[model samples]
Target: MMEERKIGRKTDLRVLKTQKAIKDAFKEMVMEMDASQITVKELSERAQIHRKTFYLHYTTIEALFEDIMKDLFQEYCRLIEQTAPDAPFDEVNRVFFTFMSRQEPYMERMVCAPSYRDFSDKLFMTMMIHNRSRYNPYANYSKEEQNVINTFLCLTSVNIYRQWVKDGKVLSLEDLIELTNRLFLHGISDVRHDL
Candidate 1:
């Protein structure tokens, strides 16, 4: 399990914050440059950190990616927890809408860079994996059945999020949730088949 180390309480929290700032800066800078063309000096300058400090936290620009990917996954998981399983569709939609309201900006920035595309793929993978395990804890389905539902959700949810972002976030959070719930809960054959 990934330990939730609260860096804020420690002296090194500042260092951690600085590292985050550097990475955030790097992310913004890379959006404007080819990842292959981004040099350590440029990244350091963008992040406002000394070259030595950047090196201390990461060996190369690529190494910073691993850490950022981990953070992206963690953030998504945090958002998923804010949603309620038993809530009405509108309520659930609100939960997701609220979640996206917070994430839309960061995602918009991250997706602009070529280096961050894989992070988007991994984000979908992580959500699918999580949903398969915990989405409906009350449903006693076989593993194969669960896998099918997870796969469907994985595709639909990712697409919805992508569309939501692309649509300039026109829908209210509640509307997004209601639409999703209508599709999943009320639209299709409610009877889930194992096949």
Candidate 2:
């Protein structure tokens, strides 16, 4: 029993290490060039893993990209869970704030590097973008309205994040969350009226 447990743990660690290696390599290549231009051979070389191994893990480059996105989102969710135990909006904001705080240095590096201009955006778009018809919140809305809402909501979130990063505001995660929730629940006119 003890030997089996030890083997399982070791196998888990090895799998994690390999996954990390692939992700890091992919990030490096993405920084160097367009994601569409990256090939599995290139990824395998950068990751220092065998081509067969890459194929074994991911059926295609798109699959690998999907995996990367899933990992990033999982990390963000984990951060949320770790930083906010209360499950309230404010607490959720704190979690977001902590996650953003951790990402500050990475964003700085990405900005200074110049080569990674659209990498972050691509990652965000990959994770967040969905067909209007598939949007969960828009299930009740008409098709045309759903399309508009989907586009508006996506653009709004992306713009806010871009502006926040560009302005270097690093606003309190809590404030950001509160503002986001408020804006989401109430229109600009409503906010103005409240003020």
The models' CA-based lDDT, in order, is 0.66, 0.62
Clashing pairs in 2: none
Tens-digit per-residue lDDT, 64-163, candidate 2:
7667656656676556445323354445434544554466443434433344445445654443342221235446889788667755665566556556
Candidate 2: which stretches are off by over 4 Å?
Answer: 1-6, 79-101, 104-151, 167-186, 189-195
TM-score of 1: 0.65
Off by over 4 Å in 1: 1-14, 30-39, 50-52, 59-63, 82-94, 111-115, 131-145, 188-195
Error of 2 at 152 (Å): 3.5
C-alpha lDDT of residue 165 in model 1:
73
lDDT of 1 by residue, 1-195 (tens): 233455445647888788878877866765676556768888888778889989888888777766776676677667666766444545544554465567545466454344565666666667557643555643698878876776676567666766777787798766777678777777656444568
Could you tell me every candidate's TM-score relative to the true structure? 0.65, 0.58
Most lDDT-accurate candidate = 1
